[model samples]
Target: MSSTTNYILGVFDDEDEVLHAVSEVKSKGIKIDEVYTPFPIHGLDTAIGHERTRLPIAAFMFGTLGMICALSLISYTMVFDWPMIIGGKDFFALPNWIPVTFEGTVLFTAFGLVITFCISNNLFPGNNVEPLDLRITDDKFVMAINLDKNKLGQDEITKALKSSGAIEVNVK
Candidate 1:
């Protein structure tokens, strides 16, 4: 089945106005699909009712995996496979393994985080997603409301946006 989705965009020139508009619109029991801004705004996530992200947890898990892999490789190569006795030390030398293990952990963590972020955000190379508004990337702050997701009529939503200092409202 093919279905069309409609979006109502509220454009604001100032960050403060957009922030205020978020609260004003939410107070009227409207659901916002997403907000686009030129730069990060402090406390905007909380204002928009977004939950805390679990990226830190994902980072820790990836780091742990890296550490395990590094340790395993060092143990196998140095202790079991080659049995190297460098600097008159034992085959399983902990001190010598420090540098390689650290490097491996850093490398894996860096790559893992990049892959995780890209996958989570659906950002892939050559993906041609259209922007809601070109000015949103430069100077404008846009609050997009999915018309199909909310029970309120378009006229009411538009009125709420206009009342909340929106410079312009457009439907797409």
Candidate 2:
């Protein structure tokens, strides 16, 4: 779904093998497209040289937006629209709004991250992706390579992946 094509992907069985292979291959000047594992493995990003994620930035922006919206709504409702006094609290005191403001900020930030992640990855329910292998989501680890450069043929890439400690290497 990501327009990745002509890439050579090497799958691994053991997480350590993937980690060691990543570090070694990268040192040998070979580029990796992506790595996938059934569970999070430590230092996977570092070994693969992946850039830091942007989800936190998205969450912060959405949280700020939510805080602004909540503050504005509270101001309009308590001060301008209804001008209500609750338990002798001042009409515009921000302390009175801390609970709702905090709640809204967290809620919007979480939802924003989810939406951004889904949109950015193009992963949503009903957006069917051709599964590489069912086992990949269960017990196996997978690596997706983008081979648009057309530099290595099947045999050469296969040999490279096999030598890198891939338990099974096959083109799909």
Q: List model 1 lDDT by residue over 53-93, tens digit each.
A: 98888888888888899999999988999897788999978
Ten residues in a row with the worst lDDT in model 2? 144-153
Give the count of colliding residue pairs in each prediction.
Answer: 0, 3
Q: Flag regions of model 1 displaced more than 4 Å.
A: 1-3
1-172 per-residue lDDT for model 2 (tens digits):
3544555667788988888878765654456777878999999987777789988889899999999989889899999999977898888988879999999899899899989999999889899887665677788887665555445566766676778888887555
Q: What lDDT does the true structure give each of the candidates?
A: 0.91, 0.78
TM-score of 1: 0.95
Evaluated at residue 123, the lDDT of candidate 1 is 94
The Cα error of candidate 1 at residue 129, in Å, is 0.3
**lDDT (Cα) of model 2:** 0.78
